[model samples]
Target: MKLPNPARRSISPFGQRGLKSFASIPGPTSLPIVGTLHKYMPIIGEYKFDRLHHNGLKKYKKYGPVIREEIVPGVNLVWLFDPNDIEVMFRCEGKYPQRRSHLALEKFRLDRPNVYNTGGLLPTNGPEWFKIRKIFQKGLSGPLAVKRFLKGTDEIILEWLERVEIIRGKQNLDYLPELSRLFLELTGHATLDLLLKSFSRDELNRHSTSSKLIKSALDTNSCILKLDNGPQLWKKFDTPLYRKLKKSQKYMENVAIDLLSLKMSLFSERSNNTQTLLEQYLSCPDLDFKDIIGMVCDFLLAGIDTATYTTGFLIYHLGKSPSIQMSLYEEAKRLLPNKDSPVTEEVLSEAFYSKAVLKELFRLRPISVGIGRVLNEDAVFSDYEVPKDTVVVSQNQVSCRLDKYVPCPNEFKPERWLKSHPLYQKNHPYLLLPFGHGPRSCIAKHLAEQNILVLLLKLIRNYKIEWNGPVLDSKSLLINMPDGPILATFHAR
Candidate 1:
């Protein structure tokens, strides 16, 4: 159906068109007040959320790359899957690039004025976002920061491996929870300079504060996705999802405060002079106790799942392809001959094939279906003029899946990432940005890469990873993860 002409409606001083008038773009059929609510019923049948990605894929196929959808009554979104259009959309992004606002997150932060009056990097914008971002770069980025944490992070991974060995002999071991614990432990150690012990053998305390924090963060993420992608019901009332989100928020705030207090106590005692990520933040005079704690909590909430899921995807693909796993094993063996040796920044840098494998894995299965940006100015996709304030989503998954962009895109070909390969020419670097790009890219890129490389360095050296189960499908909930327990048999080398 044709949309109303945006130009005819009222305009903003910044040259924005009428918010509701998107007549130039094509989208699914919609009603007056309800918008496109009825059209999504089949996809959300009885609230089974697995169809979210599938529905998006089907819609893109039907509506072409640059399509529009009014998920809510007044909110309109323009989705783009074409690489060239994505380039155009990103080029138009102003100095302060704003991701699509998380309404649920904003509301939750506002509900608790004291703990999170200034929301963390995710929801905040303009000067505040830039300020927090600069602080994050100082604490989290740089070669020195990663080098300082390598030994400690590696020690935690080794402990996790010890935990994995206990059940390695089992026919079908559930690796999901274990991986979650692994990442939680890593993030905990990196941020707080303390082992979370979330994966310890105590059933009574199995759901530790660390575990609870990760769980709450994930639940909050799922709720936020539903609010934006599904019907806009949460906007009208305090629905069950909204309530759950609030409960999760409270849990997160409490845990963050406890962590902050612990760090403060340590600071007073001068127990250790080592500058951990939290220590660096605590030293920042501009930030208050609340903001510092919020930043640390943001590290845990944002860091755990994305790192865990990305690692899982790497294992899933490598385990499925035995030859590829062998090649990776050989590469690791060549880089650092001693299997028992600790991985260093120098060694990791030379581990070219391993890095390529990670790059390829992300290209195939990005963290989410696409990256989102709220256009700061009017932009054009194809012939359609998308006005300012419109949410533009770039379909990275679809673009990477296209054979034209990357030859044999579906197949697991890590060599494509290596410039030496003939197929490498087929690759467009922009098409596979797992960490995103530009000034607002993921600040934890270096840390995450080091974490994964260290874990894989040990993992490939010690075991022949294999997976034989029902085809493991991925569900997108902020980060894409295996839909069910990843059953794998780890044979120790």
Candidate 2:
């Protein structure tokens, strides 16, 4: 986790003081004054995270670094070019506190103040955050971190590979939803040992890609989360997309409620059977039904979506990069020779090439282009002053590509991360914000990593992949997903 380059510095805190005017503010004629007042209106249906990042880089180039641009009228915002400034925000989040502004997330049931708060975990803060993090990381320590997920993930991924083979050639195979369901299945079974209930066994077990009930619950979230990037949270309620998304949110909420009820009932019965993470939370003395709903829902929303998208992107890259693909195959074959044998955790871990490949993929296609926090207090960043309540954002997309930190940043080189690589430049230890950083960052970071690593290994080991889509497209929704169906060939290995 250490940075590649060690610099003389001090582990110091930002001294809070009086608010100051913008270092520099860019005029917003890009759209109109509607955006001048409320920025979300223009960005919702048009530009997504990818475009925003690209456009941000362009604007940053023209305007200046740390441009105080507004996403909405009257709402003060800053587009930061310097990774150091962003790193400061993350490292200081636990201390100075960068508050969340997501309305959908704020409305999330699991995040309620009274019961089952996920304070330090998800979208909460203060003591509630502290308690939630302690409880969540309780069982996720040491060996369990690597063993439980790695084993379950490997087995489920093999199942997924077999399913892909079933629909191969005869019909198009969409990897996103399939991988999405697979993560839920793996996480539910391995970590929690429960079924995702997202899809039925008949649907999940079906070799037919057509069998998937890709309903409003999952599909609508694409739009719902998309809307998250738009204007004020309440304004979205008036939009047609918002109405549809709200409905999708309702179905998902109901699903979580049912799962929570089921977990609670099992708890009342003192079910001796080993519990998954959700069940364990249900049994936690501190959490109630509301808290259970909030945290568990957070898990589902956060877990299923990003995993599917990331794997799809990784495979998309593999399809494009044949030499890398072959390298991965060589690594996988060495670790998992018997085609008939199921993938094991050890085998997945042994497939180091795949791990390296995944790291590169994440560096290239992190789900979030940037993460934002509204500074609760005016804080000084070098000479500039970041005002309180101003949305403080960091660009991980650009940070990964920073030439100083990552030499040849555009290349899909995984060796840069290995311990032995000479060209490898250590990124600012806290600057890699793939999962965000500090207290309010992702608590499920380890879980998400294990799932991706396990799934990637199973994929490379069992199937040879070739992309049917263009490798260069920056399509956007809310959280990044494939621009279209990721058509690809999967010859059984």
Q: Write the per-residue lDDT of candidate 2 for residues 191-271, one digit (tens) a residue.
A: 345555544555555452222223433555556444554555546354666666556555556666765677567667764
Total clashing pairs in model 2: 13
Model 1 residue 418 lDDT score:
81
- Which parts of model 2 are misplaced by more than 4 Å? 1-33, 37-50, 108-122, 141-143, 190-192, 197-201, 204-229, 233-239, 267-275, 340-345, 402-404
Please provide, for model 1 over 447-467, each residue's C-alpha lDDT reduced to its tens digit, 9 standing for 90 to 100. 888899899888998899988
RMSD of each: 5.1, 4.6
Q: Cα lDDT of model 2 overall? A: 0.62
Give each model a TM-score.
0.91, 0.83
What's the TM for model 1?
0.91
TM-score of 2: 0.83
Q: What is the total number of backbone clashes in candidate 1?
A: 1
Among the numbered candidates, top lDDT falls to 1
